[model samples]
Target: MSRALFRSSLPELGSFSAARLRPTAAVLPFSWTTTTTRSFNSTAPIVEPVSSNNAPNPTASQVRPLALKKSHPAAPPSPIADSVKNLLPFLAAQPGHYITVHIHGFPYLVQEGDQIRLPFRMPGVLPGDVLRLNRASVIGSRDYTMKGSPHIDERVFECRATVLGVESEPLRIKIKKKRRQRRKRQAKSKHRYTILRVSELNIKNLEEAAAE
Candidate 1:
């Protein structure tokens, strides 16, 4: 009875194990397929290639006509012809001379090697800089004098000055008081000026001024 029961149970066990191990189509519920194709649209806009050779050259574009410009008239002839003729000779014969130089419309009576403190500060100049003074009112020696109607011709005289440095005024203080209140305010100022020395002064000859 025991052997018959064991053989009967073997077939039932084998069939149950085979059902669990079997592959099923239900595992994959859906499938997919892919296809590749070229796309075309007649409404697309076309772009034309630009030609670099058609562009104008940079050098050709820069060429332009130069317009003619009018120039200012020269200064009128010197007013003192007779006085200048005698004065030039006498001025040359003198030993020492002094010139009244006009700097920024202010006249400075100076001789060679005289240091002067200008009223205003000079720009773009440093120590050891040499400046040519062109405008003058008078150039004279001890006896004779040559004066300009307003300014002597710059070509007639050559005056040079050397920059020494800058000088500053002492600090100035001014006090202001309110009429009703006891409050008071102070204003302070320190002004700077340029210093120059007359380095050379020479009277040019008539021929030299005329040639220029």
Candidate 2:
């Protein structure tokens, strides 16, 4: 009886599997077929024609005139005074001279071979570098002196300084504290300065300055 029931179920299962394996045709709407055919047949993109009335005109832009600038004449250069030209030669002939040279607006009275410690460190200078001192207030020897109104012309005198090395100050410690706080802090600072020596100083002759 169990074998007869199993044989009857096998025929129903075979019929269901044959129905699933058979292919079925799918039907689509007329509008869907038309849209797909149009997309495949189109080879170029569609562009609408632009009307000439809405286009910008090249001649419609107005040309503006440039403004005229005013012209001015330059003032004449001032010539050196006759008295200074006459006195320069007498001052240059004397020996054993001292110059009041100005560096960074501060005046330093220095002679040849005098070592100077500048207040600030000089940049781009190394040991044995020679620097020319141009600004001077007074240039004098044992007999004659040539003093400028404010500052003597740098071309009249020549002064050169050699860089020796940099000198640094000792480290300073300052104690900082609050009124009610137990914690205290110490601030330390050290400053470095450049050292220079006046190597050569001379007053240029009138003929020499004119030739240069």
Candidate 3:
């Protein structure tokens, strides 16, 4: 009876060994386990997919910096040189040129056969007397510029106009009468202006002016 009891107990100990000795598969730290009382927690934080330096990509709702346009500054004006003014007499002697001529500080850009109405009546000149205009500031080319002497030589350019005589405008007569006053005075005034038709605009060569 003792030998039979030992044999049964030995079989039960072998069965317990068979059930406890089976190996369990290794579980990764990140893997979830349903049997855990709280879900399996990760010791390491979850890493998201990144673009460049491990920084997470922003969403479409994020604001982006705007590209700015660069503006160009304006160019400065050209300065006039003193050397250009010294060469003007030779330049004026050339044939058929345009000149910016000034008369008594008032500037006029004139060529031949231009008509000018003087602002006020010019005194001491008759129909055929010639007038020489000299003051000029600039003599220009399409690209090059030749400035004149601070004041042009009075004898340099001849701007002769045929004085077409004085012209009178329509008479302006204003009658003065008060609301209660019976006496009325008539004020009459008339203005006459000189008209000049430019007959010849000549920039004579020194040789030509010398011969005359």
Candidate 4:
């Protein structure tokens, strides 16, 4: 193709100075949104938050011992009733008497010279020590029986026992083991008993009981 023919065939553009550019409608600058905050006064006081876990706790060793409770005092003695005073001589006249004595709230139907093995060992007593029994519920002979309301008076009868010694049971060993375990636990237990023998048991006459 010729240069004149190519120039005549091409599209024409106007001068560059008269070109329409969007200069008045400019793009706004990018910005983040602002939030309003309240300001506090400088003279106001600040409160600290309290937590329960931050408080100090007391240990077991620093704890104080508890006070022991006071025991109830014993009751005062009373005189014998008139009905018992009248019939007491008849019960005391009989021979071969048997008494149901109580020691530590336990009943023992015993006669003179009978031996007793207490289930638990008695404390504060050694062999050959004598103990006077003052509590009894029933006292009877072969022909007559005398029953008391809860307990007979100590002035009515005299019973004594001599501590023999302490007897111990054989040691018992128990083995405990778990299945497929190499370690085993062994527990051993042995118990002791106190021996006592009744030495004297006598009933008081009417004059003797009244004088006491």
Best by TM-score: 2
TM-score of 1: 0.58
Could you give candidate 2's per-residue lDDT for residues 4-41 as a string of tens digits?
A: 99999998999999987876544437678889899988
Candidate 2: worst-modelled 10 consecutive residues by lDDT: 63-72
TM-score of each: 0.58, 0.59, 0.47, 0.57
lDDT of each residue in 103-205, candidate 1, tens digit only: 8888899999998899889999999999999999988988878888898899888999999999999999999898989989999999999999999988887
List runs of model 2 lying over 4 Å from the truth. Answer: 1-81
Cα distance off (Å), candidate 3, residue 94: 6.8
lDDT of 3 by residue, 1-212 (tens): 99999998998999989967865565444345544635455356789654352214333454222332224234565665644345555566455566676765777776677777776678888876666655677554344344555755545556666788887788999999999999999999888777777677665456666566
Off by over 4 Å in 1: 1-81
* Candidate 4, 1-212: lDDT as tens digits: 69987776554333333344434433433232112222333346779765544424433344322332224335566755775777677778888889999888889999999998888889999999999989999999987677889998899999999999999999999999999999999999899999999999999997898799
Q: Identify the superior model by TM-score, candidate 2 or candidate 4.
A: 2
True-structure lDDT of candidate 4: 0.80
Reference-based lDDT, residue 8, model 1: 97
The clash tally of candidate 1 reads 0
> Cα deviation in Å at residue 26, candidate 3?
52
Which candidate leads in lDDT? 2
| Candidates 2 and 3 compared by TM-score, better number | 2
